[model samples]
Target: MTKDKTGRLHVTVRSGRKRKLSSKLWLERQLNDPYVVRAKREGFRSRAAYKLKEIDDKYKLLKPGMAVVDLGAAPGGWSQIAAAKVGAVDRKGRVVAIDLLEMAEIPGVIFAQLDFLDDEAPEKLRAMLGGGADLVMSDMAANTTGHRKTDQLRIVGLVETAAAFACEVLKPGGAFLAKVFQSGAEAELLAQLKRDFTTIRHVKPAASRQDSSERYLLATGFRGQQRP
Candidate 1:
């Protein structure tokens, strides 16, 4: 197994029998994925960790003592990275992770079993973080419906909601990152983020599947109605 800068791990899979087209394709891709191999070697939870790690390497958002909130943190890959980047035991450093699915515990992360769409979720996360966040990231995507348009809209909704909550909890000069589909329907959300942030950009992590329509929004420099 080999891990890449993007955090995807590649594994060898025996193609003993001709399987269904999708299964065969998936198996072949996994076998060729370098990041997958690397993650396994490095003891990371998933290749997704490389996505956040690469982003942070370029953006410098994950600081040693920054407070962070992670949405859809199941399996805790992102949380693990956050805990390490933020120095779990360091003063004024912490990570708050939320997901509907149960995640294995990771050191230095506060885990919550709740859906980000839930009405009470935002307040609950803030309570866990003990106040405003320096960064709020969401790798959340709705379970695919196999219907392209529907899946895109659902993911967009999740991104929009995450952005709204980011405005609520982020400190000035904070950053927000959320998964988004590249269907070009995110104009309104992008515009809003630009208004509230100093800069907004779209990023496609190398770990993300090329065939997949997913991308990420990187918004920085929060400028909203301040909440003390």
Candidate 2:
């Protein structure tokens, strides 16, 4: 580790014979990332906590007494921010998180280990929320297939599924936020959201790596349920 002229600490990773190029690059990025260092200093679960923090700072999507549902919430980074912002610790709000992978307990987050795609998951989450949710957020990403087009399609499919679940569980005039890629395939999803929401916006927070194609779709003021 060494400080550059700008007073920024830089970490260089030496790739061993056993370490793949991708793994070495990823480790180096994590080690030098300011958000990762900040997250550790603040005791957050992961660097992802800063992404949600930056979004909520601008949009005010989280409130003191809202009911929030976090889909694909593993490692509990987003859930931690939601719990604190929504006052879940004092029982003034509710935050329910679900992911296929098991996560360690967060102080005020109600976590369930289950696949969001399962038919039973929606009803179970609704019950846990005690009714409709004020906000539904998803950071789910599908497994990549290496082909760029195929990967984009898979990401769109995952976002569509999360949006459908949000439509079913969000209260009238509630909000939905989900991670999406910048690929052009999002047109269909945006069209659908325009029909269902009063406002929709795409945002790429500073916490998101500049080299990454990731962005977030934020839709607010749902216009009630739509029948197909």
- Per-residue CA lDDT of model 1 for 131-209, tens digit only, reads 8899999988778889988877787887888998888788888999998888857778888888889998889888888
True-structure Cα RMSD, model 1: 4.0
For each of the candidates, the C-alpha root-mean-square deviation to the true structure, in angstroms, is 4.0, 1.6
Task: Output the lDDT of residue 43, model 1.
Answer: 90
Off by over 4 Å in 1: 1-19, 226-228
Error of 1 at 105 (Å): 0.6
- Predict model 2's lDDT versus the native: 0.92
Candidate maximizing TM-score: 2
Which has the greatest lDDT?
Answer: 2
Error of 2 at 33 (Å): 0.4
> How far out, in Å, is residue 194 in model 1?
1.8
lDDT of each prediction vs. the true structure? 0.84, 0.92
